[model samples]
Target: MEERKDINRLKVVLAEKKRTNKWLAETLGKDQATVSKWCTNTSQPSLEMLMRIAEALEVDMKDLLWPLKQQ
Candidate 1:
């Protein structure tokens, strides 16, 4: 059996919230480039940072993640 990794859905959530990477960057005290990386899924935020982002975006942690596929 192959193991599957869950996908990141941060960019979609940000768009649904009508927010920008710059706004998230300011909210988290991070650089826009870093936020851009996260939004693009070029890099992922640490679990701790993910929690902070959820708080900043006023969203549930699960909101940042894509739902896992059922076998």
Candidate 2:
């Protein structure tokens, strides 16, 4: 199996939560481009940032991370 390369589930979770990148950026006081990079998995957020993201998204921190393996 090809090990999954993507690190975060930000994009998927955003979609599930019906949130737009723009909304997240505005809510987090972040750059929209930065949020886009995160959603595309082109970059990652610091643990602190991730925690903040979880709060803004109203989701658990674990939900922002990809599972080791999905059955």
lDDT of 1 by residue, 11-41 (tens): 8889989999999999999999999988887
Q: Could you tell me the lDDT of residue 46 within candidate 2?
A: 91
The local lDDT score (0 to 100) that residue 61 gets in candidate 2 is 96
36, model 2: CA deviation in Å?
0.3
Point out where model 1 deviates above 4 Å: 1-6, 67-71
Top candidate on lDDT is 2
Provide the overall lDDT of each model, using Cα atoms, as 2-decimal numbers. Answer: 0.87, 0.92
- Per-residue lDDT for 1-71 in model 2, tens only? 88759999999989989999999999999999999999999999899999999999999999899654676
